[model samples]
Target: MIRGMAHHVGIYTRQSEQRASKSEASTETQWDDCVSGLPHWGLEPQHIERYEDLGISAFKDVDRPDYRRLLADAGAGRINVIVVHYMSRFSRRTAQETYDDLSPLLRNGVRLISVGEGREFHANNLFALFELLFKLQASHEESLNKSLAVRAAKDLEARLGGYTGKAPFGFTLVRETRRTDSGKPVSVKILTPDTEHEAPIVRRIAELADNWITENDPTGSVWKIARTLEKEGHKTRGQRMAKARGDARWDDKTVKRVLADPRIAGFDVESVYGTRKDGTRSTTVAEYRLVRRADGSPVQRYTPIIPAEQWYWIQGWLSDRHPGGNPHWDGKPSGLLSAMKLLFCECGATMTHGGSGFKKHYRCRRRAIKPGQHEGEVTIGAKGIEQHLARRIFAVMRAADDESALAVLAEAANRYAVQRERTVALEVTQERDRLLSERARLRRSREAHHADRERVMLKGGFVDDFARESWGETEQALAERMRSIDARIAEIGDSKAVGLPYEVWLTADTDPTGPGSWWDSADFQTKRAFFRLFFDRVSVSKARRWAGRGFPVETRVTIEWAGGVDLSDRPMVGVA
Candidate 1:
C-alpha cells in the first residue's frame, strides 16, 4: 500500500500458450517482476496477492476466475493497488471491456500499475488511459487477423485432402518416413485405420446399419444398435471417453455419427463452415469425395468398412424415416408393434417386436436370471391383433357420432387449452415480466446517471466522453434485450393459437363420406394422429382357450377410449 489508505496490492497476470510465442514470459516471470516492483510503489511483500490465469485467451470476456476475484477484492476495499507485468497481461479484450474493468477501480480510489510500461493509471492520467485502450484495440484486431489466417490455412488443408486437427474416430496418426533433397530422413504425419480393436467395432457397426436396411428391420434403430453394443460390452474410443466425468457408455448419437462418417467408406470429406447471425462460425461435413493420388487415380486411404452401395442404401432408408418423407409405405411394418407404446405384458414389461417379417410378434423383453436370458412371456401375432383392433376401433368411431362424444371432445379441448395456458403462456408471461422489470431498472440507472453527470465528471474519475458512451451502450443493450423478449412473447402467443384439436376435428368431420372412411384412407402419420387423439391406452392380457382338446393361448385386447369409454373382451385367436 502506498499510503495508509492503501493496505493491499493485487497482482494480476495472464498467459495463453496457444496465442503467445514460446519465447514469451510465463506467469511465474510476470509474478516475480510485479513482486519486485511492489516495494517501489510503497506496497509491502506481505500485502501483495497474486492472481494468474494460465492458457486463457485475453481477447474473450469469459469468466477468468482469478481476475474476477481480483476485481471483487478491489471493489470490496481489500486491495488499494493492482499490479501487472503489462496492460496486455491484464486484458487484451476490446477497449470497452478494458474501460468497464478499470473504470470502477479508478472511481473507488484504487491505482493500477504496469511494471513493463513503467506507468500508473489514475484519474488525472488521461493520456496513459487512452494509450492503454489503443493497445487493447490493436490486440483485438491482431486476434481477428490471426483467426482469419488460421481459417484460410484450414480451408486450404481440407481442399488438399489432408486431415485437420485430430484424426477422426477409427483412425490413428502415424509418422511416415521420407528422404529430403540431401538424402536425410524426414517424417510426415498421416492417418491410418486402427486395426487393433476399434477397426473391428467400426466394421461391426457398419454391418449392423447395412443389415437394418437390407433386412428392413425398423427394430434395429440407432437406439437399439447402441443398446446391443453396450450389451456386448463395447465402449466408444476417443479422448472424450478418457476425460468423461460420468459413465462413457456408447449412445445412439455416437453410433449415428460413426455410421454417417464418410471416412469409414474410404472417402475424404471437406468440412463446410457457416457463419451464424451472431458472427460465430460452425463447421459441418459438406461433401464426401473419393481421395485421389497425384496421378489423378483414386486412392484407397483405408479399407472400406461397408460397401459404398450398402452405405447409400442405408442413407436412403434413414431419409425415408424422417418426418414428411414417404410414410404411406417404406417396407412391411418393420415389426408388428413398430411404434405402439401401449402394449404391455403381464410381467409389466412393455412388449417389443420379435422375429422377422410375416412371423413378427410382440413379446415381453424382461430378463430372467441372467442379463441376456429372458423369462417366459406372452406373444401376440401382429396381423391378427391389428385386424381385431381395427374392427373394434371402427365400431367405436361409428358410435362416437352421437352427442355424448361431442361433449367429451369439447371437454378434452378445454383441458388442452388449460394445459397450454399453464405451460406455454405462463412461461412467456413470467419471462416478459422479468424483462420489463430489468428495463425499468435500467431506465432508473440511466436517469440517476444523468442527474449526477456533472458531479461524476468532476470527481468520479472516468473521462466524461467514456462515461457517456458506456451509459449509451448500456441503454442500447437493455433496449435490444427488451425487444428480443417481446419477440419471444409474440412467438409463444402465435404458437399457442396454431395447434387446437377443435380446428382439425371440425375439418375432419366435414369430410364427404364418413369419419371412419376418412380415417381408413388417411396416410400412416394421419392414422397415428387419429389413434393418439381417440385412444388413451391399449393393454393386452393372455387367456387360455381349448382348441380341439389342446389348450391354445389367445390375447385379450382392451382399449380405453379418450371419451371415457372402456372397450375390453376383444379377443384375437391363435396368437401365442
Candidate 2:
C-alpha cells in the first residue's frame, strides 16, 4: 500500500437493479465496503468522500449527479484516489470509453482501486492497464449476453402460448399450481377470459360494430359509438374516471383501437420492435395467431365474445373506410356552408356553429369564449349568407366567356409555377409535390370553367363594362404576383426560370355547370368541395341593428376568392 501520502479518497458506486440480481452489489453495500477498506489504504473516514448513482445503468450515459461531481473534483486535483466496489460499479462501458474517462483522473494524480477485485490500477504499469481493459471488456460482454438470453427466453415463452407481458383488455391472468423439481408447489400464470366485468363490454362493442357493417346502422359510426358508450356510464378498462369532473369519457380513438385489435378474435399477437430516435426499442402489434393451436385451422385461445365471421366482417369494413381506400364519407353533415372554408371574423378568428338547427348562425368562436376581451360575437344568419353567395357565383359563371376564363387560368398557373420552382430550388421534395398536386387540381377546375364559359359565349357575346373592369383588375393582380415571385426568387438566391410547360396543363373530369345549376343538383359533399376550390375565406363584420330591427340586423359579409380577389366592399344583404 502507498501510505502516508495524506490522500483524499473518493468512493464511486452505481447499482442498476433492473440490470442485476438481488445478490449483486447494491449501492448501500458498496458504500459500506469502501468505508471499511479505507484503513487498509492508509486513508481515514475524514479524508473520504462518497459518490453514489442508485438505480442507474452503468452502460448508459445518464445524468449521474454524484459521479459527475466526483470527476470534477478529481480533475481539480481535490481527489487523489477513487475507490469502487467493482469495475462494473464504476462503468460497464466498452474498454475504450472506460479508458478515456479514467485517463484524465489518472493524469491528475488520482489512483483507481476496485475493492471486489482487490486490484489497484497504476498509470505507469502496462500490466495494470491491460488488466483494466480486460475487466471492462468482460463487463460490457456480460451485459450484452444477458440481454440476448432474456429476449430469447421471452420469445420461447411467447411461442409456447404464454403471455410474456400484461394481458390485453377482456382477459385476466390466473395462476395455476405446479410441482417444482423438489416436488414443492409453485404457481404459473396464464390468460383467461374475464367474463363477468370486461367480457360483456367487449361483446357489446363487437355487436355495435357488426350492426354498423352488416345492418347499415347510421348510429354506428366510431364517434357516435364512443358517445353512446360514454352516455351509458361504461368506462374503458385501465382508464381512471373522475366522478366529480366527469372528464374520463370514451373517445373515437379508443373505439377504433378496440375494433381493430385481432386479440378479440381469440388470437395471441406479438409486437414488432422498432428503433426510436433515442436509441430505444418501441414495440407495436405486428401479427396475430390463434393461441393453443396445433393444426392449420383457426382455434380459440379462450371463449371469444365476437364470432370469427363478424370479426372478419368488421375488419373488411375498417379497411374500406381507411384513408387509403375509396372515398366513403362517414361524417355527419355539419351545416349548409360549413364545407365552405369561407367564414371568419374581422379579428381574423374563424366562425363556427353556434346555434341550434333552423335558428343556426355562424359566430366568431374566439369572441364567444371571452366576450369582454375580444370583439363580441360577430354573427350572420347561415341561410342569408348562403343564398346571397349562391346568386353572385351564378352571375359570374353565366357572364364569363372562354377568352376571359383562359386569361384568369393563365395568371393562376403562372403564380403556381413560380411557387413550385421556389419549393424545388429549396430541395423541399414533399412541399414541392404538394404544391404541384394543388396546381394540377386548379388546372382541372380551370378547364371545367373554360368549358362552361365557351357554352355561354356561343349563346351571346356578353362584353359588358363590368367584364372589362374585372379583366383589367385580374391583369393587375397577375403582374403583382409576378413581381412578388421575382422578389422571393432574388431573396432565396435562385435564378431558375419559373415557366409553365405545355405538359403542365393536364386536366381532369370535374363537373362543370352554371353555379346555380350545379348548386341545385350537387350533394352536400360536392357543394363543400366546390366552395373550398373557389373561395379562400369570408370575413364577417359586427352586426349593426337599427331600432325596431330583429335579432340579426344587416350583418356585413365579405367573400375572398382563392385567386387573390377581394370583395370586402360589396356586402351581402342579410335575411329578415
Best by TM-score: 1
Query: How do the residues 1-576 of candidate 1 rate in per-residue lDDT, one tens digit apiece?
Result: 244654687889888753333344688788888888877777664477888888777876566899889988888878888899988888877888778877988877888889888888876678977877787788778887887897886665444434556766777766666555567654545667777757778878877777766666545666777888878877677423464224567777777777766677676554545545665654444334434444222344555666544554555454333221243545444553454555676655677776777887877666664554434566777766655554444444344555544543543443343233323444454565576567677678667767676576678666767777887787787677767766765665532232344333333434322455543465664444445445556666654445654232223665666545433432221121
lDDT of 2 by residue, 321-352 (tens): 32211235443446656523467777777677
On the 0 to 100 scale, the lDDT of residue 175 in model 2 is 67
Local accuracy by lDDT, each model:
0.62, 0.62
| Runs with alpha carbons beyond 4 Å of true place in candidate 2 | 1-10, 18-25, 45-56, 59-73, 76-80, 166-508, 511-576
Clash count per candidate: 1, 1
Model 1 misplaced regions, further than 4 Å: 1-6, 9-42, 45-56, 60-78, 95-97, 114-120, 124-131, 163-166, 172-201, 204-256, 260-263, 266-576
